[model samples]
Target chain A: MKRILSIMGFVFAMGSITSLLIIGMDALTFERILANEQALFQSKVLDAFDVPYTTATINEVFIQNVEAIELDVNGETVTVYRDPKTGRISMEISGGGVWGPIIGVLTLEPDFVTIANVAILQQEETPGLGGRITEPAYLAKYIGVVFNPDVVVTKNIPSADNEVDAITGATGTSTRFQIILNDTHAKLFPLLQALEN
Target chain B: MNRFWKRLQYTKWFNISKDGIFKENPIVVAVLGICSALAVTNRVENAIAMGLAVMFVVTASSLVVSAIRNFIPSRVRMITYMVIISSFVILVQMFLEAFFPVIAASLGAYLGLIVTNCIVMGRAEAFAVKNPLKYTFFDGVANSLGYMWILIAVAFFREILAFGTLLNFRVMPDTWVNWTVMALAPGGFFVLALIIWGVREWAKYFDVAAE
Candidate 1:
C-alpha cells in the first residue's frame, strides 16, 4: 500500500511539474508564435501577388496591396486575397497527400481561369519526390495552365490547356493534388466571378 | 603533471565524457537517433540547427532527470522521463517557432518529434537516473556533441556534392554540375553508411557477436 501510494504520488508530482513547465512556455511564446504564423501566411499571399516586400515589411505591404474577400460558401467562410492592380485572386487550398495534408496558396489570373502562380505553405509528402511540389521550379510549371473545366496533372507531355506535368515520380500526390485544386477552384471560382461582375 | 593527467583519466566525469563522445557515441557506436541524423544532414545549416536543438534538449532533460532521480518511483520512472523530455521538447519547439520560424518550418515535424529521439530517453534511463547531476551534465553534453559532429561531417559532404555549395555558399566552380541524387534520401543513406563504416573502422569498434 505504501509503495503504490508513493508511485501514485510520484506520478502526480511529475505530471504537475511537466505541465507547469509547458504551460509557462506556451504563455511566453503564444503571442510571438501566432504573429510568426500570421506573418508567414501574409508573406505567402504577398508572394502569390508578386508584391515586393522584405520580411520586415510583410504586414505593411500586405495591407497596402492585397484585399481580402470573405465569401460564404456552403455555410463556410472562405477568405480569398486579391491583387488590386492585376485583379489576380489567391486562395488557400489543402487536401490529403500521401503522407499528410498539402497546403498551398493558388493564385489565378484576372480571367479566374489561368494559374498565375503557386506557393506551398505546408506539406509532409516524401522529400525530393512528392515534396517537389514545394519547389519553385516545379510550381513554375503550373503557371499559364488553365482551368477551363478542370486541371489535370498528367505524366505525359501536357498537350491541353488544363493539363500540367506532374511531379516525375509522385503520381499519388499528383492525383490527390489534382482533386484538391479542382475542388477548391470549383467552389470559389463562381463567387470570385460574381465579385468581379 | 603526468600524475594529475592519469588521475583525471581515472575520474568518473572524465570517463563518462570520453565514453559518451567516443566509446559509446549515440550515433556511431550505440547507433541511436539515426532518423534525424539522416533527415537533417542533407544541408549543413539544417544539420547545425538540428545539432544545437538536440544538444539543448539532451543536456537539459538529463540534468533535470539526474536532479530528481531520487524522488522518482521505479514503476513510474519511464513515464516521468517521457513527461520531462516532452516538456523540454515543447519548450524548444515553441522557442524555435517564435524566434526562428524559418528553421522551425524547415525542421517541420522533426522538431516536435525530438520527443521520440532515443538518445534523450536512453540517457535518462541509463545514466541520469543512476548518476549525480554534475556527471550527467557532462555525459549529456558529450553525447550530444558526438551526435552533432557526425551530423556536421555528413552534411559537409552532402551539401557540397548535392548543391555544389557549403552552407549555401558557391563552393564548387561554375562548371560543376550538382549531383541530383545526392539531395535525395538514398544519398543520405549512402553517406551515412560510409560515415558509420569509416568511424567504426577508425575507432576499431567491432561487435564480436555479429561476427
Candidate 2:
C-alpha cells in the first residue's frame, strides 16, 4: 500500500510540475510566436506579389501594398490578399496530403487564369518525396501554368498549358494538390471577377 | 604532470565524459537517436541548430532528472522521465519559434519530436537516475556533443556534395555540378553507415557476437 501510494504521489507531482513548466513557457512565448507566424505568412504574400521588403519592414510593406478582401463563400469567411499595383490575387489553400494536411499560398495573374507563384506555408508530407512540394524549384513549375477550366498534375510530360509535372515519386500528394488548387480556384475566381467590376 | 594526467583520467567525472563522448558515443557506439540524425544532416546549418537544440535538451533534462532522482518511484520512473523531457522540449520549441523561427521551421516536426529521441530518455534512465547531479551534467553535455559532432561531420560531406556549398556558401568551383542523389535519404544512409564503420574500426570496437 505504501509503495502504490508513493507511485501515485510521484505521478501526480510529476504531471503537475511538467504541466506548469510548459504552461509558463507557452505564456511567455505566445505573442512572439504568433507575430513570427504572421510575419512568415506576410513575407510569402510579399514574395508572390514581387514586393521587396526586409524582415523589419514586412508588416509595414504588407499594410501599405496588399489589400485583404473578406468574402463569404457558403457562410465560410475566406480572406484573400490582392496586390493593388498589379491586380494579382493570392489566397491560402489547404487539403489532406498523404501523411497530413498541406497548406500553401496560390497567386494568380490579373486574368485569374494563370498562376504567378505557389509558396507552401505549411506541409507535413514524406520528406524527400511528397515533402519536396515545399521546394521553391518545385513550386516554380506552377508559374505561368494556366488554369483554363482546371489544372492537372501529371506524371508524364506536361503537353498542355493546364498541366504541370507531379513530384517524381509523390503521385498521391500531387493528385491531392491538384484537387486543392482546382477547388480553391473554382470557389474564389468568380468572387474575384465580380470584385474587378 | 604525468601523475596529474593519470589522476584526472581516473576521476569519475572525467571518465564519465570520456565514455559519453568517445567510448560509448550515442551515435557511433550505442547507435541511439538515428532518426533526427538522418533527417536533419542534409544541411550544415541545420545540423548545427539541431545539435545545439539536442545539447540543451539532454543537458537540462538530465540535470532535472538527476536532481530529483531520490524522490522518484521506480514504477513511475519512465513516466517521470518522459514528462521532464517533454516539458524541456516544449520550452526549446517555444524559444526557437519566438526568436529563431527560420531554424524552427527548417527543423519542422523534428523539433517537437526531440521528446522521442532515444538519447534523451536513454541518458535520463541509464545515468541520471543513478548518478549525482554534477556527474550527470558532464555525462549529458558529453553525450550531446558526441551526437552533435557526428551530425556536423555527416552534414559537412553531405552539404558539400549535394549543393556544392557549405552552409549555403559556394565552396565548390563554378564547374562543379550538384550530386542530386547526395541530398536524398540513401545518401544519409551511406554517409552515416560509413561514419559508424570508420569510427568503430578506428576505436577497435568490434561486435563480439559477430566475431
Candidate 3:
C-alpha cells in the first residue's frame, strides 16, 4: 500500500508538471494560432470577392475591402463579410465529410442570387479523391453557379448553370458535400436575406 | 569525470551512435515506425517536417526519461515514458500550428500519431531507461537521423515520380506525366523495400572489405 501510494504520487506529480508545461506552451502560441485561423478564413472570404492578398497582407486587405459583421441567423450567430462596393456577402459553412469535418466559405454576387466564388477553408475529404473538393479546379466549377434550387453535383459532365462535376471516385463525398453545401445555403440564405431588407 | 567524458566521445559509444545511422538504422535496417514512414513520404516537405518532429520528441523525451530513470517504478515505466513523450509531441504540434499552419494542416493526424511511434517508445524502453543521460541524448540523435534519412530518401523518389516535383517545385518538363501510385501507400512500400535491399547490400560489401 505504501509503495503504491508513492508510485501514484510520482505519477501524479509527473502528469501535473507535463500539464503545466503544455499550458505554458498553449498560452504562448494561442494568439498566433488564433490569428492564423482567422487569416485562413478571411483569405477564403476574400477569395470570393476575387481579391488577392499574401499572408503578410491578408489583414491589410481584409481591412481595406471587407466589412465583417455578426448576424443572428435563426438561433445561431453567423459572421457575414460584406463587400462595400459590390454588396456581396460571404458566409462560412461547416459539415461532416466521410472521415472528418469539412469547412468552406462562399460568396454571392451583388444580386445575392449568383455565386461569385466558393472556396474550401478546411476539409478532411480523402486527398486526391474526396479531398479534391477544395481544389481550385473543383471550387472554380462552382463559380457562376446559381443557388436558387441549391447547387447540384452531377457525375456526368455539368452543362446547366446550377450543376457541377462530382469528384471522380468520390461520389459519396461528392453527394455529402452537395448536401452540406445546399443545407448550409438553405439554413443561412433566409437569414442573409433578412440582412438585405 | 574527464576520462569518462573522453571515452564516451571516442570509444564504443561512437560506434553505437554510428550503428543507428546504418547497421541498426531504425527505418531501413530494423524497420520500426514504418507506418509514418509510408504515410508521410509521398511529399519531401512532409517527410522533413515529420523527421524534425520525431527528432524533437525522441531527443526531449529520452533526455527527460533518462534523467528520471531511477525514480520510475518498473511496472509503470512504460506509462511514465508515454506521458513524457506525448507531452513533447503536443508541444511540437502546438508549435507547428502556431508558426507553420500550412504544414500542420497537410500533416493532419500524423502529427498527433507521433506519440505512438515505435522508435520513440522502443528507445525509451530499450535504451533511455537504462542509459545515462549523455549517452541517451546521443542515441536519440543517432536514431532520429537513422529514421529521418530513410524517410527523406523514400520521399525523394516518391515526390519526383508522383508529382514530377521536389518540395512542390516542378523539375520535370511541362509535358511530363506523373505516376499516381507513387503518391499513394503502395509506392512508399516499394520504395522502402528497394532502399532496404540497397542499403543492406552496400553495408554488407563494406563490411566484407573491412574484414
Candidate 4:
C-alpha cells in the first residue's frame, strides 16, 4: 500500500511540473503570438486593398478611408472588415469546408456591383485540391466579380451572374465558398441599398 | 567522464547507418512519420524544408531525452518525453518564423503538428528510453537521414509531375503539359504507394544470409 501511494505521489508531482512548464511557456509567448496574428491580418487586409505597403506603412497611406466595423450576426458581434479610406462597409464571410473552416474578407466598392478585394483568413481544405482555392490564382478570380442581387458561382465564365472558375477536383470547396459568398451578398445588398436611400 | 567518452565512440558509425537506413527506417519500414510527409510533399521545396526541420528536432529531442532518462520516473515517462519534444518543436517554429517566413506561411499549422509525429515519439520511446546518451543521439541523427532521403525522393517525383519542377526548379520543358492531379492529395497517396512498393522489392533482394 505504501509503495503504491508513493508511486502515485510521484506521478502527481511529475504531472504538476510538466503542466506548469507548458503553462509558463504559453504565457510567455502569448503576447508575441497575438501580435503576429494581428500583423498578419492587417497585412492581408492591406493586400486586399492593393495598398503597396506593409500594414505598418498602410496607416500613413490611407489613414482616413478604411474603418473597421463590427457586425451583429445572430446577436453575435464579429469584426466584419475595414475600409480605411472611404469608411465604406466590408463584409466578413465565414464558411465551412469539407475538412475544416474557410473564412475570408470581401471588401466591396460602394456601388456593390464589384468586389474590391477578397482575402482568405483561414482554410484547411485538402492541399493541392480545395487548398488551391486559397492561392492567388483563385483569390484573384474573386476580384471584379460582380456582386449583383443574384450573385452565384457558375463554371461557365462570363455568365450573367457572378462566375469564378471552379478548381478542378475541388467542386465541393468551390460550392461551399460560393454558398457563403451568396449569403453575405444577400444580407449586405439590402443593407447597402437602405443606407444609400 | 572517461567511461562516457569511451561510450561515445563505442558504436561503429557504418553499423548505425545500416540499421537506420534499411533495418529500422523510420518511414518505409517503421512507418513512423507520414502526416507531414503527405501534407508537405506536394511541393518539393516544402518537403525539403520539413525534412531538415524534422532532422533537427528528432536529433535534439533524442539527445535531451536520453540525457534525462534516469531522472524521469517510469510512471510519467511519456509526458516527460513529450515535454522535451514540444520544447524542441517550439524552438524550430521560432527559427522558421524568423528566417524563412514564406515557407513558414506555407507550412501553416502543419509545422506545429510535428509534435504529434510518430517518428519523434517512436525514437524517444523505443531507442532513447534505453540507450546511452551518445549512441541514442547518433541513432536519432541516422534515422532522420533515412527519413530525409526517402521524402526528398518521393517529393522529387511528386513535384516534377505535379508542378513540372524539382525543388521549384523547372525540369520539364515548358511546352509539355503538366499533370495538375500530381500536385493534389491523391497524387501524394499514389506516389507514396509506389515508393513503398519499390522499397519492399529492394529489401527482398538484399535480404542477408545467416551469419
> Would you estimate the TM-scores of all the predictions?
0.94, 0.95, 0.89, 0.74
Supply candidate 3's per-residue lDDT for A113: 65
On TM-score, the leading prediction is 2
Best of the two (2, 3) by DockQ: 2
The residue pairs that clash in candidate 3, if any, are: none
Task: Indicate whether candidate 3 or candidate 4 has the larger DockQ.
Answer: 3
DockQ class, candidate 1: high
**Which of 3 and 4 is the better model by lDDT?**
3
Lowest summed lDDT over 10 consecutive residues: which window, candidate 1 chain B?
Answer: B180-189
Single out the weakest 10-residue window by summed lDDT for candidate 1 chain A. Answer: A119-128
lDDT of 4: 0.76
- lDDT per residue as tens, model 3, A48-114: 7878899899999999999987878666787889999888988887888999888888788866768
Report candidate 4's fraction of native contacts: 0.07
Tell me the number of clashing residue pairs for each predicted model.
0, 0, 0, 8
Return the candidate ranking by TM-score, descending: 2, 1, 3, 4
lDDT of 1 by residue, B1-211 (tens): 9999999999988998888888888999999999998888889999999999999999999999999888988788898898889889999999999999999988888899899999999999999999999989999999999999999999999999999999889999999999978777888899999999898998899988964
Candidate that would win on lDDT: 2
lDDT of 1: 0.91
- What tens digits encode model 3's per-residue C-alpha lDDT throughout B48-135? 9999999999999999999999999998999999999999999999999999999998888899999999999999999999999989
Q: Compared with the true structure, what per-residue lDDT tens digits does model 1 show for residues A92-138?
A: 99999899998888999999999998888888998778988888899
